[model samples]
Target: MTPDEARTLLEQSLRVVVPDADLTGLGGETDIRERFELDSLDFVEIVERLSQGAGFRIEEDEDLRTIDAIVGLLSRGTPHPV
Candidate 1:
């Protein structure tokens, strides 16, 4: 997937967890957890949703702190299982 595609998927997943979040001005380097006030469970849900949308598994060990990180992971193609 491309960066744009990954970003879109992330937005959709985030919306499921935070319906009122204003993502229009979100920066790529912004910390998602802090920005969205996501608890551990919410973050996990977003990861799962993103994986499903991308048709691949996103390992828990991967660095997913920022939108840029997650987008990079998604656009890199299927990640090898650890």
Candidate 2:
């Protein structure tokens, strides 16, 4: 997956979780936990969704400070145990 592809996936996934929010205004440096009202459960769901879609186990410990970084990591691929 490329960064653009990952971002599109992330945006789509995030939209599902935050349907009322305007995803177009989201910044690359926004802290999802504080900015998007996402809890750990939300993180798990997002990770699961991304993993299933990406064919890789995206780690939970990754620093997801920005959407760019999140997508970048997904594009680069992170090998984790099933």
Candidate 3:
């Protein structure tokens, strides 16, 4: 997928994690953990849902580690297990 598409998906997934939070204008460089108040469970869930939606398997250890890293991974479309 393209970066724009991935970004949109990330925004949508993040909304699921924070339905009421205002994060519409945040850029890819924005730190989600600090900016969106995403806890460990929420982050994991987001990754899980995103991976499922993207038709891939994502692991918390191999996939998600930090907010910046997660953003990079999503934006760049990291390789995943099919």
Candidate with more favorable, higher TM-score: 1 or 3: 1
Q: Tell me the tens digit of each residue's lDDT in model 1 across 42-81.
A: 9999989988898888887889999999999999867554
Candidate 1 versus the native: TM-score?
A: 0.93
Ordering by TM-score: 1, 2, 3
Q: What C-alpha lDDT do the candidate models reach, one value each?
A: 0.90, 0.78, 0.69
Candidate 1 wrongly placed segments (more than 4 Å): 80-82
Candidate 3 on 3-76: residue-level lDDT in tens? 66666777788788889878666754676777877788888888887786666766677635444466556656
Clashes of each: 0, 0, 0
Count of clashing pairs, candidate 2: 0
Better of 2 and 3 by lDDT: 2
Worst 10 residues of 1 by lDDT: 73-82
Off by over 4 Å in 2: none
* Full-model lDDT, candidate 3: 0.69
Question: Which residue pairs collide, candidate 2?
Answer: none
Better of 1 and 3 by lDDT: 1
Q: Any residue pairs clashing in model 1, and if so which?
A: none
